[model samples]
Target: MFVSQPQYEFPFPPDLEQPGSQHWRMVELTLHAPWFLLTVEIFDAEMLDCSMSRTICIAWDYDLAEVLRGLDPETVLGIVCMMPAWASPNGQWSSKEVREVWMCSSPAGQSVLLVDPAGEEFDCGLVPEHVEPLKKDLVLRVAPAKPRRRPHSRRKTPPTGNRRSRRASARKSEA
Candidate 1:
């Protein structure tokens, strides 16, 4: 038997320039095994332009606060990912590689800063026009705890009245 997974919809911020033009919005965030993926959907008016995905290794166990910390004005943001060692003519060499990923920044307000492996900044044109909504969506995914609810019982309550009296009444009614 096959089972379907639940699909969750998150609230997205309004479009950047009115409603009937081009804009970018974050559509989904999902964990695919060892990688955590953030997907951005681009829209040209009502039509979908394309989708872009950015991923980070799940081993890092990054949380919302840790992600937002990269935006701190006083701190220099640098995220490095370690790679497997390779064999060379001389000997084995371990490589410390940095992949292109999204980094947060707060120059005016929260925004995404895209940096290449060479430490150069470039615009992917996929970053949402506004980022606060994206941040809120990330927080919801990281800590999606809902208020606890009491479990309901399926068994019906016992008939109200003395057991003997109820039996006697039932007998009389049958007669």
Candidate 2:
């Protein structure tokens, strides 16, 4: 797959919900990527080598990370998902695994557990006190090779008036 888009909803068990609560939040993952990275192993906390794609390890929540760094690692939640690959009607492409990863990657509010790979997956049932702030805008930018060019190239030539400018300048200088 060229890129992957994963939208995940963390499954909450029966015990996790409050008495009146409708559901418990397991996790949510939404990803829009260009191409798939081909690996899943982790060498550093900053990146991951997945079987089908290379992904940088990053936490998108700056507010959440700071809070996590101070609390107990075990108290935090971990979301781990794995999927295959798929294609769409438009030229856009993606992987099923990427979608699984998205569940672990997306968090809308604060107090979330997110990182590259501190030690193990969230399944370890442990969390750090405070995670590093997310503004920490952990983003990956790729250059588009063939940006959709305009059907009609519009060559904008500067308004031609150099001679007029010279005359104006000369008149001002004389004055």
Candidate 3:
């Protein structure tokens, strides 16, 4: 029951750096204005690694912004998950990743994500040399809305014919 990995590279490629292959299950992402709900089926091993690894740690996907506020280490390594809701009105979204530090379970043993504002741009080389970037946990590329249902969803029958004409049609049916 052992595995071989390089101290877990943060922002690593899902196809490779993962403890195992990236098992992105069908997670349901519901964006309810101001907040979002994520039902992710993250691999159990990944979750265990979050707390078991002595040299590696997995942070929530909302702390990347805060890290910017603090003094970044000259040389550090880690992976960060991006928020899926930081999209702008123009439809442009942040390509940079986000990391969050949450207090889960009384003592804090979880790494769930929280929404964050995308006010800064990520340097081509954001993380330290040791760190790498992974694909978004839930990358939502929202394009412009296409043509909707014909006449819109609120289709209404035009007011055709006069009131007496309508009565004649009803009488014909009665006969």
Candidate 4:
């Protein structure tokens, strides 16, 4: 049996100076060939407080099949929330607080589950539009079976002779 490791791609914006201010709003996952693209929309709470909602789109890539197969009901598959850290009076950013709310596959593989840092679990109900295709693909596609090796068969070996000499002898006989 062959199993592939999941590859992830998370591209943060170049201008993101304050990593602690961003908070995730919504997450969308779509399958693009061998890659599962997770799109997360985040807004800065500080910007929202100033009457401006600045939303940014961040993406992550993963192998969803591998992820699902390896997931334990108690294990977190991925994180969705980003905690904020305020700057100190010296204009230096304080140590960022890491509060993560994670998503995982259910034990039955029929639905997704969410777990917060506090150990509270939530049921993810009603498949979203972005994930509908992925769910359908998983349902419709059959699991891959291990490749089988064919039985060995005996065969006659080729004559032991140099190719050039054999060809010359054959040419003389023909002439």
TM-scores for every candidate against the unseen true structure: 0.19, 0.17, 0.19, 0.19
Between candidates 3 and 4, which one is better according to lDDT? 4
Look at candidate 1 and give me any clashing residue pairs.
none
Expressed as tens digits, the lDDT of each residue in 45-92 for candidate 3 is: 656533211122223223332332242221122233333344434454
Mark the regions of model 4 whose C-alpha exceeds 4 Å error after superposition.
Answer: 1-78, 81-109, 127-175
What is candidate 1's TM-score against the reference? 0.19
lDDT digits (tens) for residues 14-115 of candidate 2? 685657544323333454322222222223445443212223333233323343244333222232222213223354443222111111231332333222
RMSD of 1: 24.2
Candidate 1, which segments miss by more than 4 Å at Cα? 1-58, 61-65, 68-73, 86-100, 103-116, 119-175
Better of 2 and 3 by TM-score: 3
Which is the better candidate, 1 or 2, if ranked by lDDT? Answer: 1
Instruction: Return the lDDT, model 1, position 132.
Output: 43
Tens-digit lDDT string for candidate 4 (1-175): 1122223324457586466543233333342111122122233566842322122222221233334334331222123322112213355323221122223333334443333345554332332334322332221111112232223624345336842211000000111
Give each model's clash number. 0, 44, 12, 0
lDDT of 1: 0.30
In order, the Cα lDDT scores of the candidates are 0.30, 0.28, 0.28, 0.28
Best by lDDT: 1
